[model samples]
Target: MASHQNLNFQGQIPGEFLIARIMQIHASISKLESLRPSKQVNILFSHLVKLCILPSSIDIKALPQEVQQMRQSLIILCARAESLLELEFATYLSKISLPLNDLNRFPYYENYVKLAKLEYGALIENTGVAQLKKVAFVGSGPMPLTSIILASQHMKSTHFDNIDIDETANNLARRIVSSDDEIEKRMKFLTSDIMEVKEKLGEYDCIILAALVGNEEEKAKILGHIRKYMKEGGVLLVRSAKGARAFLYPVVEEHELFDFKVLSIFHPTNDVINSVVLLRKSLIYT
Candidate 1:
């Protein structure tokens, strides 16, 4: 499972090692930092643990037929690596300001997180005043960055609910949000499987789906639930992939369902590859 393979965020065939190296260094520093006292860092290795780096691109050619067949599994492994590394890095951010995290050097993972949140913010800001009342972010992981941004902006007058089935992640998300007074005042974390939350369906003007959620069956089930409970004309924003293999999450085409009409599609300017669909719930669900 630890076999080395060449992969890049843009599907570029870069034999480049920047992100891969950063992940290795991050894991190493995390361990090293855990051993030393913060007041008087170990003279020998203190600053070494604070290193950061970014990405570079390369070009290439055809993949073997067998490799093509295994692309999905390869992507799944990549997604898992990204999620675990991201969670670890988000934990690191807890110790200092976000800027101090040096987003450019840490751009691969951390900026991915921030842009996932900001993609929705761009839409909400354009929405008419008080139009975006209550908001729910499903599949919010340990950071709940999207919910934090919305609560601090559009949903400030109401509540921003972050729901996920993972209890540990929910707790971690709560701790992260609580650190910010404004986000804490408006954001709430709930550890409940989506199917069990009927009331949550109708409680918001908007719903943002996390990209990590699995297959078509699971998404269809959730969409069915949304059809039943979502308010008429409410917005449903889904994070998807347009032209690349994403980790554990399946790359799906724009949803073909009767309950929601495609309002527009948004791609992050950074070209992160995760596409967001802004949909409006149609009154009729067949």
Candidate 2:
């Protein structure tokens, strides 16, 4: 991890300085032919992630106007970095003859394992739902590791609907888990925008919104749709970010969650990049 001292913040928020570093990193990342598993791209992205997590006391909104203006662009870049990595890994895994039990050989597999445990623990602790019969993961992307880890390791009997708007991504996800008979039997991939499947939302006992699913307004719209259609008292695990991590991922605002009963909002201060918000659809919609 890059030390905050290296940036020389001098006891004040490095607003423009941080923006300059971000732009420099963006320029480097943009120049890459592909954000796949490469030493250069990995180092560049690691720097960007480190910059976002650097110790900072000021809220993201309080940053300079120039930095604030670049927040959305930063979020998009971060998402692209993550998506490209997943796509590359998924594509590679799909072509290989690796067994499902060997998935931990992937470099970033442990991150998903850690994240899955954190989320599953959060769900059980906050919602008291230790056994989920049906769960849906919105924007599961090319590599649906969270669902895979949860279904295989935690909730073995649960059925997971991995939803993504991109059919190619869904196909890749399906192929990645095809070797695992147990997982393949339990995981179902759906290719459609989340809003398009509002009628089927009520089937899931829990739904997880991925971090890169959408921007703030788009996420609110999706959340509203889920709130209106998901079964009463069903839990929604929303991946969010707080502190400096907000620049890497969109932060779910409190105002957008008025319709749902907000149960718990956890901001991880450790290696976990995403914060999790646990909310349950109100039994009585107002």
lDDT of 1 by residue, 2-104 (tens): 2123323554324334334334433443444343233222321222221111122311124345433444444444445545654665566655555222323
Q: Residue by residue across 1-286, what tens digits does model 2's lDDT show?
A: 3434476565545656665677677667777887666898788877877776665554766777776667777788778778888888788889988646567776678777888999999999987878899999999998888998999889999999999999999998888899888899999999998888887999999999998887987989989988889998899999988877887889898888999888888887767788889899986543
Stretches of candidate 1 off by over 4 Å are 1-69, 93-118, 121-131, 153-158, 245-249, 284-286
Candidate 1: worst-modelled 10 consecutive residues by lDDT: 44-53
Maximum-TM-score candidate: 2
Pairs with backbone N, CA or C atoms under 3 Å apart (clashes), candidate 2: none
What is the clash tally of candidate 2? 0
How far in Å is the alpha carbon of 139 misplaced in model 2?
0.6
Candidate 2 deviates by what RMSD? 2.8
Looking at model 2, report the run of 10 residues with the lowest lDDT sum: 1-10
Candidate 1 TM-score, true structure as reference: 0.66
Supply candidate 2's per-residue lDDT for 12.
Answer: 44
In model 1, pairs of residues that clash are: 79-247
